[model samples]
Target: MLNLGTVLAFGALVLFGGWAVAAGVATRSLSAVNAVFLSYVASLTLVGGYVLSVRRPISGTGTDVAFALLSGAFLAIGSISFYAALERGSVAIVSAIAALYFVVPVVVGVLYFEADLSTANVAGIGLAIVAVVLIAS
Candidate 1:
């Protein structure tokens, strides 16, 4: 039987693949900045409301909120850059480059959270880097 981790990883892959497809479609229909802004607004509205209703108050310090906002700004910039890339390059190429985020998040996870990495994880990251090199070329 498939283990829980395998199932969850598959689910995440499916979700992110779907999101990338949707982002491509949105890029075709709207400006990237607008697309990102609208999507974030709608998602945050629902999620924030649910959190407020079901959980404790968001008691973050001002600095914490500012840092979160800064991170979001970077995300917005990245989305805009991606849309620009899609406009200039083939969707397949752009998508492949964007998928390099998988490797990035793994490195960031290890660095920021001191997450333990298995041999498989390192191999996966190496393969992803190779894929990016091939795709970019």
Candidate 2:
């Protein structure tokens, strides 16, 4: 049996990334604060339905709760800043630069969390940075 979970996740990311760029551009006409609020309201409404439909437990240990809250804070901050950046910068450049954020966690994981780093992983990280720099410049 083919698993649709992974496939759908990737598909959603691509679709939503495109939507984000377009939404940013559309929101560019408004002040960053106004745009962020509007986006948040829309997102919250949509997610409310999603939350209701998705059956999941919220129970977790202190560590897990802390991690979840931290992740949510960073995500909210990142999204708000990204929308603000889109108002002042080209969507292509801003999105490309923001996309490189994964590297931060990779470095953190390797340095503190005992994440295994093979030569290929290191090389890919280096190459990814170069690619983003080239694209941004």
Candidate 3:
């Protein structure tokens, strides 16, 4: 029987694969900014409704709304840039380069959150960087 970690890993892989396929379809159908905006709005509607229904109201300073809007704006820009890269480069190359975002959270966790990285995780990070370099080259 598969372990919990293995099951979670498999699920993540499936989710990412599905996301890539859907993104490709979306890119083909509309401008990446449009695709991103529509998707974000839809997701916000669903997730926001669920949260409001299930969770107690938090104190919403204007800062909270500003932050959420800023995040959505950044996501839209990133998606547009990615779609543009895909147009100019091979999908495989663009995807491999884009995968470097995985490092962003790790770096933020270490630098800002003071999370400890195991030796194995450090090695994994090194390997990921090397893979990105090789794939981009």
Best by lDDT: 2
TM-score each candidate: 0.68, 0.86, 0.67
* Top-scoring candidate (TM-score): 2
**Tens digit of per-residue lDDT, candidate 2, span 1-137:** 54799889889889879767766777657877777777778888998889888977678899999999999889788877888888888887888888888899998998999999999998998998899899999
* lDDT (0 to 1) per candidate: 0.81, 0.83, 0.80
List of clashing residue pairs for candidate 2:
none
Once superposed on the true structure, which residue ranges of model 1 sit more than 4 Å away at CA? 1-9, 60-67, 105-121
Give the TM-score (vs. native) of candidate 2.
Answer: 0.86
Candidate 3 weakest ten by summed lDDT: 83-92
Scored against the true structure, residue 121 in model 3 reaches a CA lDDT of 99
lDDT for predicted candidate 1 compared with the true structure: 0.81
Deviation (Å) of 132 in candidate 2: 0.9
lDDT of 3 by residue, 1-137 (tens): 99999999999888876765676677775776777677678878998999989987766789997988898787778877877675566677788888788798899899999999999999999999898899889
Which residue pairs clash in candidate 1? none
Give the Cα RMSD of candidate 1: 3.4
Worst 10 residues of 1 by lDDT: 83-92
lDDT of 2: 0.83
